[model samples]
Target: MEGICFLPTFLVIWSSSTFIVSYLIALFEHDVDVIFPYISEIGAKPPESCIFGLMTIITAFAGMATIYARYKFVEKLNEKAGVPPALNQAAFWIGMLSCLGICFVATFQETTIIQMHDAGAILFFVSGVLYTTLQSIISYKAYPYGCSLALCHTRTGMATIAFLAVSPTIICVLLHRTEDKDYVFHLVSAVSEWIVAFSFIFFFTYIHDFKRFTLKLRTEFVS
Candidate 1:
């Protein structure tokens, strides 16, 4: 019951907060003229880059929400199963470091590259990988928590669904009007989306089984 209650709350907060923050950053940080390179087009002088950025940002935040909610619920479950707070804290910190490493690499690339949008997609893909890896760590660490298994599974499920659902939509929309189907740019985008989609799947399955294994333990104990 607690898991159910906390999961939705964490999801709502994390999703809303991250999306708002990322949207504002995209609006100011990205310049549309670079990608579109047109002077007289729809909504002249408006930030077209922000639209795509918003889409990506929203997608990312949704995933984060799922991860956060799952982590918290799992933490509670671990507590019930005699897991120590120190262990959870250690695992969480390690996950944070992993996530930071990916973000830092992406930041370095963004700074060095001039035409960063395409490369940025690679970074986003990396980010998704790190995100999943961290969630997997959390799920694995909380194995003693019985009810937490469900939340852990939910987290992976949501992340996988979100990425697979969002990436193709984003790619198809961006590439739809583009005539350069054979261009290297299109190829890179396709590859990046594929990487992101599969990473999410890997993380989902990994975390789901981790949770289920823990739940199985709990069930045995109760029986």
Candidate 2:
């Protein structure tokens, strides 16, 4: 896990930057309404399409790597302290499912396969929330497991993240309340999507333990 922060940090910055740029491009190239246009609308056209596709590949790999690194790190620490696996294999497999959803969403544009795209989006969000929450819990309990104080210092932030992560569910209620106002529902949905994204990014920041790992070249032969 040495230098493990690099890829996750890159993935966050890359995904955020590309999505923002692509969303801007989509606004100019498509008939996208500013407030209500879903983030997926960005992938409906232009340089946006290419950006989304690239973002997807980068994110998929990075997300999987992040999961693996965190799980293995936690597993090792837990083993050392004689604590059973905190999140365990279930969390890892669930994370992989989330990765699949992310890849699916990126590879197929919502404009092309609306149902499939929506399904993927749903899976990604739900699984991501679950995964992050589980990791947060595991980290909270991982005292003396060599998790840095900074990494485990998510007390106040964890509450904020929990509140933010409920954005989509709250939007669901709002969506039903504003049944007749399509624009309002759409606008709310867009906001909720961004909320989820930001919350997830912040949650990953809590996994600062990877800073302890470092990479080095091994000159050993691959016999």
Task: Give per-model TM-scores.
Answer: 0.38, 0.81
What is the clash tally of candidate 2? 2
In candidate 1, what are the lDDT values of residues 1-223, reduced to their tens digit? 2223433344345434433443344445553223322111111222433343344344444444444444555565764555566655554454444344333333333324424433444445545554554554555455645435666666666556545544653465367447554444444444444344444434333333333322212334554
Per-residue lDDT of candidate 2, residues 188-218 (tens digit): 5677777766666743573466776653456
Candidate 1, residue 33: how far the Cα is off, in Å: 20
- lDDT per prediction? 0.43, 0.69
Residue 150, candidate 2: C-alpha displacement in angstroms? 6.3
lDDT of 1 at 18: 36
Query: How far out, in Å, is residue 38 in model 2?
Result: 1.3
